[model samples]
Target chain A: MRISDKYRYLGIKLTPQRLAILSYLDGNRSHPSAEDIYRSVRKEFPTMSVSTVYNTLDVLKEKGDVQELTIDPRKKRYGPVNTPHNHLMCNKCRHIVDINKEFKFTLPSSMTEGFELTGNHVEFFGFCSNCRKKQ
Target chain B: MRISDKYRYLGIKLTPQRLAILSYLDGNRSHPSAEDIYRSVRKEFPTMSVSTVYNTLDVLKEKGDVQELTIDPRKKRYGPVNTPHNHLMCNKCRHIVDINKEFKFTLPSSMTEGFELTGNHVEFFGFCSNCRKKQ
Candidate 1:
């Protein structure tokens, strides 16, 4: 998708760096961190700073256009918002696989005893087929 | 529990600073971060360092004696491992409440198509009762 058009839809500023960041994230399932995005986008814009990538990501996250995943506690990973889904992280390789299927869960009364319900995310940790084969 | 005894169970070194950290973490449900623990433990052991807190947490985490939570994207929170459960974070107050109940969720075949599932966690984000009342 065109960067300017994406900015219009996301109601964000159309900066060259922001466009590059968004373009890199568009349909990206790798769930990259700020450093990952910075390294990839730097190939095109050598002058772009890591902070720019982080700032753009922060804006995208605040706008709900990008999802920040915590599957890996060491660093925050970003995923595209094209589809709403959970994630499965391979323990061996640390590769995050998108779980596109939605699972209905009836929260036990004890779990939601005193709070209003909002949004919930399920993170599954496992070994991918390739990783399992190595094991 | 006695710090030395706790260390014995955890198979960790029984140092004074380690004792202080373990004492602070024992039965702690607030899920404090490394900075939080450092500030609290530093009061008793004025010579304690932030690196000590992080190192101790890392050791405890590796041993499965503590659970590291990523409910907050900014920092890693530590919780006692007395029980296994999910978490609910209050968006307004940024308070993390423990949901001590097992939830049964059946992942659709497509979600686990190429992965060998190990475990999963449900992170619920919303406003707590107090926050909801204020809102």
Candidate 2:
């Protein structure tokens, strides 16, 4: 779906900044952080504030339109995909890619500590091809 | 192993502050962040700095004595467990627990995107019993 149509389908407000953000994220696989998104969009919207980017991301995350990844220790990365899957990140370049496959593993009921498992995310870390060549 | 003996095993300098931090983290399952550690340590030291906590954590992380968790979006949390395992977090209270079991998963070669898989961590998020009771 197009960016505008996606927000419309989700009943999100169609602001110009949001439109620009959605356009940037529509098929973005980099799993960009809020700063990355802000920097990317600011090229076109120079007056865009980082707080606005964070707020928009918060709304999108609350709406389940995007997945916020804690794969990187330095910052949170956002992905537009909603499918249940794991993430693979390059330890060298910090490049992130979606695994797009279900890695099902049952946490023994004994270890659950009386908590129900709603969902799980796996982050696999290694050197990407480019980073490997650099080393 | 005791905190002092653990640092001795890793050949880390045993400063009074590091000892204080390590003693605090010994068998700690709360997964406190750098700020959390700083705040906790400051109660006794009164003048302990956040940077000292972070530097100590960095050394501990490098020595493979602690694991840094990105489960919290606001900050990075640390665990003293060195075992290979996953983490479970309470989505409501932000409480984190170590899932001390092997959750072995294999990624098909097709999904690797030319990256070698070094390690993977699973973060399971849900409400804790206390939070559930509150609802």
In candidate 1, what are the lDDT values of residues B18-114, reduced to their tens digit? Answer: 6677678888877788999999999998988899888877665544455666678788887765445478766455577777776656577676758
lDDT of model 2, residue B85: 46
Candidate 1 iRMS, in Å? 5.0
lDDT of each: 0.71, 0.73
> What fraction of native interface contacts does model 1 preserve?
0.63
For candidate 2, lDDT tens digit of each residue in B60-104? 654445566667888888766543547787655667778877666
* Candidate maximizing DockQ: 2
Q: After superposition, how far is residue B81 of candidate 2 from its true place, in Å?
A: 1.8
Could you give the fnat of all candidates in order?
A: 0.63, 0.62
Question: Which CAPRI tier for candidate 1?
Answer: acceptable
Q: What are the chain A TM-scores for all the models, listed individually?
A: 0.64, 0.62
Give lDDT for model 2: 0.73
